[model samples]
Target: MPTLSESRSRLLVSEAGIPVSNWETADSTQEAVSLAKNLGFPVVVKLCGDEIAHKTERGLVRLNLKTEDAVEEAADELLSSVTADDGEVTLLVSEQIRGNRELIVGLVRDEQFGPCVMLGIGGILAEAVADVAFRLAPLSRSEASDLIDDLSMQSLLDSFRGEPAVDREALINVLCALGDLGSDQEVLSVDLNPLIVANGVPIAVDALVETVEG
Candidate 1:
């Protein structure tokens, strides 16, 4: 299996009607700066390439950049950090999203069960919490709704602090979209982490897709 980079994976989800953070690809530091300015201050920059799959672990991601200089510096550092094995690296400038709630949605292939859709509590503590639910695909709107209800931490979906309650319809759409992908023969898996709830709508900030050669 081959893993798609963040930008490519994001495109896949976006095409499936999943909301994603605003972003653009940049081939140079100057281009990155220009894109960041257009996206507004407080953006994120990441080194992206087909072969650079584990960017965060490799220090290729920069977050909360508030100015042109910051974007430029981060873009330069990210580009410079690329290794020969990384292939053709580029910069991905994305809008910064903030929310108290983070959720995960994905598709996986189980040898015996075929395709399955997953939902869970996401972010850095995802592994520790491990609050997740799985359902066989392709899920109907009703099944997707039930899947969301399956999570043990239902309070996380409710209005918290000052943020509005998560829009359940939007989340259902996401799960259905993943289920749609799971039915595709070429798609091996899809991972959307930290689906930040902004203004009650879930938006994917990062994604990864694993695929098989057709």
Candidate 2:
């Protein structure tokens, strides 16, 4: 399966009614700086391309840029880092989002079971913690809510460290949207990691979508 670029992945989920952080693409450092200014201070810049997956692992992502200079520098460096193997690359500038909690949501096609929706505790140690729940696609509102209850780290869903509790309805919609997206024959999988609970609303800050073709 070929993974869509971060921008494309975010667009795919957003079109499915999944919430995502505000972002824009720029072809040049100046354009990136302009977009960052429009998005307010403390932005994130990334080198995005259809062929360039695992950006963080490749050091193509620059986060917490608080000024135009920082955005410009990061954008320039990111653009310069691209190689022929990266196919085509563009600068993605988005608002910097923060939260005390993170969750993961996704869809997968099981060879036998077909499509399944997943919910999990996310962040840097997602795999280490391994707290997750899964259900067959085309879920009901009630079934989607059950997936939330299935997670072992229940406390994470509650108000913590002065942050509000996770917005259950919004999350349910995200899961339900993934379920709907799963039914699409061309979409192989969808991964939304570190769905930041900003002011209690789950907003996907990073996403990756696997599709059958470009």
Q: Considering every candidate listed, which one attains the maximal lDDT?
A: 2
lDDT of 1 at 15: 99
Evaluate all candidate structures by whole-model CA lDDT and list the values in order: 0.90, 0.93
List, residue by residue over 39-119, the lDDT tens digit for candidate 2.
Answer: 999999999999988988999989999988989889888988889899988899999999989998899999999999999
What's the CA error at residue 39 for candidate 1, in Å? 1.2
Clashing pairs in 2: none
In candidate 1, how many clashes are counted?
0
Residue pairs in clash, model 1: none
How well does model 2 score by local distance difference test?
Answer: 0.93
Report the number of clashing residue pairs per model: 0, 0
User: What is the TM-score of candidate 1?
Assistant: 0.97
Please report, as a residue range, the 10-residue window in candidate 1 with the lowest summed lDDT.
Answer: 48-57
